[model samples]
Target: MKAWALLGAPKNQWPSNIKAKLLAAKKSKDLIIGVDRGALLLEELGLTADLAVGDFDSLQKDELERIESKVSDIRYSLPEKDLTDSELIMRCAFCDYQVSHLAILGATGGRLDHFMSNLLMVLKPEFNPFAEKIELIDQQNSIKFYNAGKHTIYQIPDYNYFGVVTLTAVQHLNIAGAKYSLADFNGDYPISFSSNEFLSEKKPLELSLKKGTVAVIQSKDIDRFQNI
Candidate 1:
């Protein structure tokens, strides 16, 4: 699948882990789009976007002009619009590029409001069916959703941690090949099952579902909670 990864410059610049993911995506000819200040981040990294989108609100006049002059492809959304730059990225990805999937970076690890909005934006019903294609990756984790099915989890190099979070109420959710195994495990809302590890070094992990949706997050970044 031809993937498009969007990087949003939300106050802070991209983290090392997130940068690696973007570079990895670029290797596969994944189209990269930047929103607002994110475009500047892309420029700072010596990377130019396939297309630049969103209002020029976050940048100075000189910066905006420089970007506009250099980037021939762009979609400038009005500042009066209801959608955020991140939303603009989603719109272009689905409505324009018609991409099967997208990976979004720099949406996390900043202002709480911006982070939450970028995250919850993917949960909209119009995009829910293709939610599998959208992921919000950061320094600490890579997260995405699965509606209801059996999925073979691929191994990401250096990804040593995982967690199962019930977005809605779920029953009969079975997770295999983990430090804490489960069978028909009922996960309640607001309850994030955390700090789990893969047990089998040979096979891929399997998650079987019975009802509702499950959000899985995997990470190789060391937990800051235990960084002593």
Candidate 2:
């Protein structure tokens, strides 16, 4: 089964159509797991989370009580635990629930450290096996992880730009069906092939890699100043 995890990033950073996205997931019977303040967001949207997981340091007594009342299954963690709330929820989704695919929302655009942590957590030995099964999504971007392999990436609508970023030293990288294709590229360190676009939305973008973990980020231009 698929699962969708809602993390506790800033509300302003949430996708404008977050409700619609969640509704679609709900329609597809995807398990919804809310992390910390993300549970509150679900409540505010008149939806109940399938499970709630977090230390909930950001919540007050009443807010925690409210979530407790709404969600049937809640997992509490110590605030001083070694794992971050994001990692906790991810582990729960993958290990406990054994979800095939986990789509994470509200993981970006708030507290650069937290965003970075979420992005890099999949690199851990424990999570690396499931890297390609996880995706981080926000208003302006959708980021998918990959291990060394030939992969086909279908375009996500409204995302005009596509990028391939190496999280580690990558070898024999090739990109096709893009505005700017790469052939037999190798890098000793993390690098980004950014600002590429799909040659045709109908055709899938092809990527091949011999070694390393990679992140495919599809994004749309947004007015940085408008929300600030």
Candidate 3:
């Protein structure tokens, strides 16, 4: 798969494992997009964005200049625009490069509004086509969406728990190979099955849905939450 990385500005420090993952993706020919101060953060980590984009109000003039000097391509939006810098990155990624698979970093532990916006953006009409290809990733968890279909989820060595949440009403949802197994579950609104663990460390989790879309999250232990 062609991977794309999008970085945002968050209050928490970026995790080392995720940094390594981004580097691996870069080595595999994935492109990176950095928004505002995220561009500076990428430069600090010895990485350069293929495209650096944002309103850039948060960055000082010298910082912006530094990013401009290093990034191969850059675009600026008006500070008063409707979309957040993160959304701008996603828009350009899809329109300019037809990005299909994307990994997002620095999306959590920031302003609550920004964090919630990042999570819900995938459900927007403009994002529906790429829903399954987008993921919100951090050191503690990786979140992905799926439309009605049979799917298999693998255990991430870094995470010990998983959750399945209905973004909308779902019908006939079934899950297996987890601590809690559900069969023929139906719900009228968004529902969350949280803090579940793999049945066996060696096997993958199985899930199927006859109708509706869902979000799946593989997360580290709660005690490790601080690290995120």
Candidate 4:
């Protein structure tokens, strides 16, 4: 099964066609897990959350009550817990639901700390095994994780730019089928290879890494940057 974890980023940061996305997911019978105010967003969209998970500190009493009344399955966490709400939701998706793919939405354009936590969580040992199955998405960008291996990435429609960034010290890395190709690139620390485009949409971008984790981001040019 596939699952979608909706986070609590500001509504303005949500994708313009979020409703359509959710509707499609629903049609495919994907599990929808809402985190914190994300549950509220689903409710507002006239959608039902399969499960709700979060401390919900961002929601007012009435709002929390509303979600409690609507959603049947909820896992409440303490605000002082060791794991972030996003992490908890991911764990539930992979371990409990046994989802083969997990798409995360509303993870960006919030507090920088929160965004970083969501982006880097897949690097953790507990989550690393599923890195390739996870994706973080927003209005303008789609971020997917990769481990040490040769992988093929197909171009995403409407996204003109592609980027690769190391999450840790990386060994020999190679990128091909892109405007700016790389051969045997090595880095001791995190670095970004940005603004690279696919040479042809019909061709798949190839990536090979000997060690460490990397995130490949596909993005489109937007008229104005959303506030972070």
TM-score of each: 0.83, 0.94, 0.88, 0.96
lDDT by residue (1-228, candidate 1, tens digit) is 455445554534344655666677678777888777777787876667777888878789999998888876799999798887777777778788888788777777667788777766656676667767787776667888877788888656678888888777787888887888778877666457788887655667799888767778887766567436
Model 1 residue 153 CA deviation in Å: 0.5
Off by over 4 Å in 3: 11-13, 222-228
TM-score of 4: 0.96
- Candidate 4 lDDT over 1-228, as tens digits, reads 999888888777677899999989988999998899999988888788999999888899999999999888899989889888988887888998899999999988879899999999988899899999999988889999999999999999878899999999999899998999999989999999999998777888999999999999999887764453
lDDT of 1 at 222: 65
Candidate 2 lDDT, tens digit per residue, 58-146? 98999999999879999998878888877887788888889999999988778899899999998888889999999898888899999
Ranking by lDDT: 4, 2, 3, 1
Which residue pairs clash in candidate 2? none
The TM-score, computed over Cα atoms with residue i paired to residue i, of candidate 2 is: 0.94
Predicted structure with the largest lDDT when compared to the true one: 4
lDDT, residue 209, candidate 3? 94
Clashes of 3: 0
Locate the minimum summed-lDDT window of 10 residues in model 1.
5-14
Error (Å) of candidate 2 at residue 15 is 1.6
In model 2, the runs with Cα more than 4 Å from the true position are 223-228
Candidate 3, TM-score vs. the true structure?
0.88
What is the Cα-based TM-score of model 1?
Answer: 0.83
Which predicted model would earn the best TM-score? 4
Say which prediction, candidate 3 or candidate 4, comes out ahead on lDDT: 4
